[model samples]
Target: MDKNQLGVQYMQEGNWEEAAKAFNDAIEENPKDPVAYINFGNVLSAVDDDEKAVKFYQKAIEIDEHAGAAYYSIGNVFFTQDRFTEAKKMFETAMKKGLESSDNFFMLGLTLVQLNQGKLALPYLQRSVELNEHDAEARFQYGLCLAQLELIDEAILQLEKCIELDPDHSDAFYNLGVSFAFKETSVKAIEMFNKALEIQPDHLLAGHAKKLIENNL
Candidate 1:
């Protein structure tokens, strides 16, 4: 097989050094191949060499300006560094260049949320859950975005679905409790909080919420 294929195989086996060497060989094999640069960048990224990763990704973009995977990789590096603005830009460019994945959508949506642009994040988060409905984390985030928009019923559904998918998800139960509390459904809120606490006994917020609900009722 080709160097790129060997590189991918090494990566799949978690052999970082061999993977990097194979990818380096792949790049040398076809210096103008954007895919080689992107794959090299992926190896660097997996090794947490964000600075070097960006260089390879940029090289890929230089070779082919429409390298969506390169842009998405850059976005991931930026997002991890908390440079959400640049991350958002790169992710948007990736999407424009035909990058489509549940992870990409989820990260872009999460970046928007971190930027305090939850309203704008709604559609991306919704799309993420649509693409991977079994992802409890995505469902939890989608639920929060809906709650922020006062779409209580919609938020409740997502949070409930999250709990169904992962019964040990304490935060999902806690958020569901908060949603119910926001709607003045005290009994239901208390029950949700109790469930959350049951799942995670050390969940301080859940314990507090349960007591607060009981006292008020």
Candidate 2:
């Protein structure tokens, strides 16, 4: 395999040192290749070297102004740092640079959610789910954005699909309980809360909601 592909395989195996070596070789082989710089940045990012990662990503961008993956990687760094506004900008730029991946849409949507712009986040999150139907986390986030908008039924649908894709998702179960409670379906709400508790015994929200509902009933 080529050095870049070898680097990616090493990354997938969680061998950061070898991945870095492979990427370094790739960069040495072709200094103008933006993909190598991006891959190197990803290694640094995985290792929690955010500052160095950003520098590598910047180098990729310098080599290729239209490098969408570089922008996307930088956005991820900002997102992990909770710099949501900056993350939003980078993801938007990535989109404008022709990166229409599901992950780009998801990150942008998630950034908007972090910024308390649920209404704005909804469409991007929806598009992410449309692009990758099997992504449980995307479904869960879309459900959360819907819930925040007071679209409880739609939220419940998404949350249900999330749990179907990932049955052990306690958060989805807990949120499902909340959605059912909003519909005044106490029994179903309690059942969902119990399911959440079964999955995660220390789910405080689910426990509290169950008690609150029982007391009211």
Candidate 3:
């Protein structure tokens, strides 16, 4: 089998060292192979070698200026470093270069939220939810963005959807409670918090929500 295929299999098997070696061998055999560089970079990133991973990603981009995976990888590295602006730029560039995936939109939205640009993040978060409506995390994040925009009704709807998709999603329940709390519906908030605690007995947010409900009562 080709080294690229071997590298992919190793990566899938969680054999990071073997995956890196296979990709490196592929790179040695064909220095211009952007896939090899990208795979190598992924393995390095998996091993927490962000510095080397960045170089490999750069090399992949140099070989193929439109390497969306390379751009995404670099964006992930930047995100890990808390450089949200740079990460957002890289993710946007990847999307512009035709790297349109739910993950792309989700990461972009998450970065925008972290940067306190929830208004700007809203569309992307909404897109992520549209792409995967059953994605509990995406729906939960969409609720957060909507709440930030003071669209309380829409936020509650999204949070309800998240809870429906994954009944065990404690965070969704907790957030839904918060939305109810915002609307000054302490009874509903308490009910949601109770549901969250039922799902995750040790849920910290659920405990906090319970306290708030008691105070309001």
Candidate 4:
């Protein structure tokens, strides 16, 4: 069998080390094979060597400037390292190069939120929600962005949708409680806190919300 075929066989069998070695050999045999670099990078990423993986991904992009997967992979490595600015730049580059996955947009939105640029994150988050409205985390984060913009009612609706989609999401319940608290609806806030506690018995925010409710009551 060819080196590429053998490398793929090893990769499918979960022999990542062997897969990396085989793919590396394939690259050595054909220096211009972008797929070999990309496959090797994937193995490195799976093995948690993100720094090396980024270099291999970069090599793939150098071979093909429009390699959206390469750009996305590099962005993921930067994000894992908490280099939000670099990650954002790389994600933008990937998008500009026609990366159209919902996950890509979702990651971009999440990074923007982490940087406290929720307004800038809105369009990406909105696109993600439009693609999959039942994504609980996406809905919850969209609500958070809305709340940050002082769109209280819309935020509450989004949080409510999150809870509806995943009834066991303690964070969604907790955030909904916070939204109610912001509106001075102590009763509703208490209810949401109770729901959160039901889902996550050890949730710190739920316990704190309970205390606040009692104090206000």
Candidate 5:
């Protein structure tokens, strides 16, 4: 239909060149359209050109100061580049600008986790899980942050929820095993380790833990 819609279609099809052309046309038609700039940024981000993508996203913000997606896009680039502090600021700004995506909250929480502030990460990660309970990765990260805080029982719940959401999540099982071990529940810990190994036979850590548990260590 329109250049913006066409650009989105091309982007979904993984045709960066055509997507760029369509976005460029949209921008040429209306330089003030923040959405066009955001779409252009999406294409740049898809092609792993984060530096250029940041320019486009920043332009979108300049065009419309409240464009939350623009802020979120920049935050994603920062995250990819391991600029956790900057990414946290961008993500927080996105929320203040009214972007309510579960992934936005997840990324913000994960950034705090990266910054080694698990206590601060807790609320954001909890909100992420509340918004989208089916996201196993979010649950897993929340579980991990809980474990870092020595909230082992709460961590077990989150890890179990992660496993419930994704039965094949080897990390969830392995971590659950570790959590049980911390509670001195050796049999349950062994079971979880065994389950992890069953799902991933080459899980070295799980194998090691399972052996130790079986020997009553």
Candidate 6:
């Protein structure tokens, strides 16, 4: 395989040192290849060297202004640091630069959610789910945003799909319970809460909601 592809394989195996070395070799072979710089930046990011990672990403961007993956990598670093606004800008730029990957859309949506702009996050989250139907987290997040927007039915559908994709996801069960409760289907809500508790006995919200409903009944 080519050095860049080998680097990516190393990265997938979580061998950051080897990945970095492979990427370094790739860069040496082709100094202007933005992909190598972005791959190296990812390795740096994996090692928690955020400052170095950003520099590498910036170098990739400098080499090719259209390096959408570089912007996406920088966005991930900013997101981890809770720099929501900067993360949002980077993700947006990635999107504008033709990064139509599901991950990029998901990160942008999540950034908007972190910034308390759930309304604005909805479409992006929906697009992310549309792009990758098997992504349980994306579906869960979309469900959550829909619930927050008082679109209970839509929330329930997404949460149910999320649960189907990942049956062990306690949070999805709990959220499904909440959505059912919003629709006044107390029996279904209680069943969902019980399922959540079965998956995660320490699910505080599910426990509380179950107790509250029992008391009322």
**Candidate 2's residue-wise lDDT over 158-207, tens digit each?**
99999999999999999999999999999999999999999999999999
lDDT (tens digit, per residue) of candidate 3 on 1-217:
9999999999899999899889989999999999899999999999899999999999999999999989988999999999999999999998998988888898999999999999999999999888887788899899989988999999999999988888988888888888899899888999999999999999998898799679758
Q: Which pairs of residues collide in candidate 3?
A: none
Model 2 TM-score is 0.99
User: Number of backbone collisions per candidate, in order?
Assistant: 0, 0, 0, 0, 0, 0
Give the lDDT ranking, best first: 2, 6, 5, 1, 3, 4
Which portions of model 4 miss their true places by more than 4 Å?
1-36
Residue 34 displacement (Å), model 3: 1.2
lDDT winner between candidates 1 and 4: 1
Q: Can you list the residue pairs that collide in candidate 6?
A: none
Give candidate 6's error at residue 146 in angstroms: 0.3
Let me know the TM-score candidate 5 reaches against the reference structure: 0.92
Rank by TM-score, highest first. Answer: 2, 6, 5, 1, 3, 4
Per-residue lDDT, model 4, residue 69, is 73
Cα-lDDT of candidate 4 = 0.88
Model 6 poorest ten-residue lDDT run: 208-217
The C-alpha local distance difference test score for the whole of candidate 2 amounts to 0.98
Q: How far is 23's C-alpha from truth in model 5 (Å)?
A: 2.0
Off by over 4 Å in 3: none
Model 3 vs truth, CA RMSD: 1.8
What's the CA error at residue 109 for candidate 6, in Å?
0.7
Give the distance in Å from residue 20's predicted Cα in candidate 6 to where it truly belongs. 1.0
